[model samples]
Target: MDQNQIPYPGIAHTIKDKKALLARVRRIQGQVAALERALEQDSDCSAVLQQIAAIRGAVNGLMAQVLEGHLREHLGTEDQTPEERRDNLKQVLSVLRSYLK
Candidate 1:
């Protein structure tokens, strides 16, 4: 794996949660479309801004959900050696740093 890229730890959990995740994505898409329509219709700035904020919050929520699952799934496995677990933790920390930025 490249140093710049952390391995995503939530692949299995994501597969398990695919339907709910997809639903959230679909809702975000709809929010974006609504924002576009608001722009086209010359809606008030406050309303447009509100829609943008809503989309951002929804996206953040989804990210948090996935990150939570990644930690839960990857860090608790009994099979990994201490070194392997440390490496996995480092990967997760790297991702968290980027996400925070």
Candidate 2:
């Protein structure tokens, strides 16, 4: 069966994946809370910038994991028609561009 027609191994047991993603999201949540507290406290600009950098890194990592999972599940195999392949390629490029932004 084509890769797209089959479930990804990670997706099949996605409880683990979900938990990990949730953990990252929760940490980001905490970061946001901390940032709010920092703002309330009028923390230094440098300190706020550092926290923002950390949050950005966390978000990028999470996006990477999600993109990897999607590529493996949907783009790891062949397409039966040129039109279908072009469409999939377009989708992949669009997602990549969005993530890069």
The alpha-carbon deviation from the true structure for residue 33 of candidate 1, after best TM-score superposition, in angstroms, is 0.9
Ten residues in sequence with the least summed lDDT for candidate 2: 1-10
- Predicted model with the maximum lDDT: 1
**Candidate 1 TM-score versus the reference:** 0.85
Across 1-101, the per-residue lDDT of candidate 1 in tens digits comes to 66666565447989899999999999999999999999999999999999999999999999999888887788877988897788788888887887889
lDDT of 2 by residue, 1-101 (tens): 43334222334424548989899899999998898899899999999999999889988888888777666555665743666555555666766776777
What lDDT would each prediction earn against the true structure? 0.88, 0.73
Candidate 1: global Cα-lDDT? 0.88
lDDT score, candidate 2, position 70 = 61
- Highest-scoring model, TM-score: 1
- What are the RMSD figures for all models against the true structure? 2.0, 6.6
Write down the TM-score of every candidate: 0.85, 0.72
